[model samples]
Target: ILRETETDVLVSYLPVGAEEATKWYVEQALTAGCAFVNCIPVFIGREPYWRKRFAQAGLPIIGDDIKSQVGATIVHRMLARLFQERGVRLERTSQLNVGGNMDFYNMLERERLESKKISKTNAVTSMLDHELDPSDIHVGPSDYVPWLSDRKFCHIRMEGRTFGDVPLNLELKLEVWDSPNSAGVVIDAIRCCKLAMDRGLSGALIAPSAYFMKAPPVQYKDDKAHRMVEKFIADLMRMDPDTARKVLNNEITAEQAVQIFERLDPETARGVIKAGIFNVEGLTPIRGAAKVAREFGVDYGKFTEEENTYLRGLMFLFYAWTRQNTPNWFRYITRNPGGFLAKFLAPWFAVVLWNNTIDEELEQSLPPWKRDQLHLITGYKDEDGKDIIIYFRGAPFVDALE
Candidate 1:
């Protein structure tokens, strides 16, 4: 839909566990011709192939992780930054996060937990303009408790602080609902992506990623990043007279306008059609030849029953001419009228051509004995639908004429 919807940008706030599915989403966006902003920890925005694809599509993209307004990643990053900036040697830090949501349930699959760890770990570590060893930091989702519902609670601890080589400690606890906590940030991302598309800018967007995500390609302070977005939006609004008018009236959907432009591209339109992601009218139907071919693997022009009739005829004749042990041909003939005519044309020792069909006049013109034999073979009723029957010498002919 990113394409045909003429979307300037698409912001994906997919569930946490949807890594592979997110790749598929990116493919759809690229194929459909829309800017993509990934707001999940699926690693696509960070991965080179996805980055290259976005560049090739000429669409702006940002993100691999979304941050809540006051969530764990931001708070953890702040504490980590405070320690480094204050000249206090950091000893240890840990953020234990617990949440109840489908995102949490999916993360229970530890095999899918790698990117999440990388995201949470890097969010804090990246804050220090200097390097920190692996043993010093502890991050990632620790547990899922069903009773909590959508509420998420996080405990952040950093054991370091102050001058004079003094021993200091910090412990913080936070709690909030998971989905709503991130919705505001997601909304901001959506608008930023739209703004990028409006300017015909493509590839990864740095500003929003730095401000709004836990793990952007780069990092920036929350307040600084927020100011940059506000200024960019203001400038973009000024350039578009129509958007400016909307802004004046307080009637603009900053993100939606971008999507409208994206959908107008032909390639994106076709992707929307193929994915059935968008519902439009008067496209091709999934019926008749198309349906049969796709579902049954049977091509209409190749090996249809009528097309293979001659081969069918040969099979029938092979049984009959050799007088092989076979079931009654008449029984078979009665069951399949089309197959009967198909078989009767089989080439063998005899070949007959007749212009007239077995009508009343033709039947009456035959000799009486021949008529009687034909009648008996056809149960005293003409096989070809003539109602004529003949009694011969006061005895019914029961033997096969062949």
Candidate 2:
């Protein structure tokens, strides 16, 4: 509606899990000739088709998701990095996230949760070098507690080796204000998108996305991502000399330039930089196809092999990284069948696996016909000290339970 009244840019602050609606809005923005800044977990900004569309139309766009300034993901990622750098043999890890928001409410549906899980899981998993089985690592939003409002709590646990055979563990709990936690970062993202418009940059902004999002088109270390945002901000200042000078002289607010640029046409926006009408700011000139895409308004470059390699490498690393840290015996059982069978043959393995100390307790209770009819039960001690019985649907014998 605003675009019909001559709005030039559309900055969407959609919540998570609104994948289809977010795409619909992006299409609406394109039809309106308004540039898009997608601040959500939907895949549009990172996907090739939409990126190509925006680039072709010469419309600026930034992001698939916004990262909180000092949120749990970064904190956990930093700790994981510390463990890896300090040579800890990280065996297993999990993050249980709880939040109260419409976003959190929406996520309870489960069906719309795939990308959210992927984004959060990959954020932590990308940092590791070793492979981990998918089962060993548990990283997902665990629950929604309504009383918390926008407050979210995250519990992160890691288990690994210290030096010799010494065991080490890490546990951290983070409580934060969710929507407000991300607002400041979105401010920077808006600036970055506007600057990208002015400079004519497009498709897969490596630095800005890495710094300000949980899932970027590519992954980089936190420090590198920070450096990239700083560089982008500096470049934006240089692209507008009059605004730069005004801000330097304290004659105009930086917010004023932001508002003005938000209204400029894509061509006029690009002209401001090409005419050298603005002072060149930023730590380095924007390089890579992101710059080309912005300038030409079309991402001619295809996704590279390096990205695929990184994705596979990160997934492999995560699968190997967290396996040993979990308690399930299935992971080990599949790996060493010979040793496992030997252990199972010994009486010790049976006792240890089943916790059956009494010899009589190990005896079969059901006859063949009764066993086949599912008339099988397990015995245990209740508080009353009498034999406690639990029935099973399938005829699982004592030996089979082992």
Candidate 3:
């Protein structure tokens, strides 16, 4: 039927006891060139052998166990994460589910239930950072009430200790239509498979599987899984072959493609840089400011007349006191380093000390006579090697002056 219909995806929701048969069906689908979406608890997608075969065949596969849109397992996992994040040590947890679906009836055979139990148990326990004793966690199908046909009821309980050894616990019940609870998830998984096929992608799709299945090939945190799925979909939808080719050929970057698509002009680009709206090569703000200034034909190191006067006044104050009573001030500071006089002199000393240290370091690094020639030039320089006065200037302040 898959080959005749030319199906894009084959969704498998086979019965619980048909694990062996399901494997055969998956193989059949792959052979028929149909993308597979396993909506049952079988290891076909997660198992290495099947994954390798599917990759070799160049067909996308998703699954292990289907996840309901709002299921007992998801709820339990979220609550467990909540407890751990809030610093509550979860001492015990359990999720009991009762349903009247064919699935529930099949699970009546305990032999067919081991995989389901493991999948559901791991779904919750994986969210916890600490180890849990096998005895402390209970997660599996409980009973089948035929009259309730397709209705599932779930009871979840969590017991934990908070600050001061205070006891806290949460208990909740959820009632849902068993089959339809997962129907939406199956539809989404099928669509993801179709999307992968459209993109000429094969093998296991990590994001969709992680978001939609209980036992994905690779597990991810719920939020991260959600984000990955979002990105996957966005990438699929936004991918332009021409743009992608250009990016691959080094004609433009992915970011530049986005900017071009947004119709960004040079003026707006400059504004974005000046407004600190973009990160350039992981440059620090000071260095970034210098780069921007150079791009805009501005002097990064050019101090205003007012700033020069202030700096000159500070220099004069330091020189006057040092020339008049150097020995006495040095002795006072040494005796009472935390004193107001010492505190007052500290900033001036720091500036001169740092300047001299930088000068000495530069001189030592350079050849002997070149150091003297280099000392003839002070302040900063542009890329063109023109001398420019260097001063600290905030972008907002510069903008205000403009």
lDDT by residue (223-337, candidate 2, tens digit) is 8888877866864564464454443334344444454444345455565445433333321111111122233321112324332222222122122212322322333333322
Candidate 1 global CA lDDT score: 0.59
lDDT of 2 at 140: 78
Candidate 3 Cα errors over 4 Å, as ranges: 240-402
State how far residue 30 of model 2 sits from its true place (Å). 1.8
Per-model TM-score, in order, reads: 0.57, 0.59, 0.62
Ranking by TM-score: 3, 2, 1
Model 1 per-residue lDDT at 33: 83
- Model 2 misplaced stretches (Cα beyond 4 Å): 240-402
Model 1 per-residue lDDT tens digits across residues 135-216: 8888988888999999999999888746887878899999998888889988888888887676555677777777887777
lDDT of 2 at 49: 90
Error of 3 at 298 (Å): 35
Across residues 85-202, which tens digit of lDDT does each residue of candidate 3 receive? 9999999998999988888998889899888888888888899999899999999899988987999999999999999999998999999988888889888888888877765567
Question: CA shift at 202, candidate 2, in angstroms?
Answer: 2.8
Q: Which regions in candidate 1 have their CA more than 4 angstroms from the true location? A: 1-8, 240-402
CA error at residue 206 for candidate 2, angstroms: 2.3
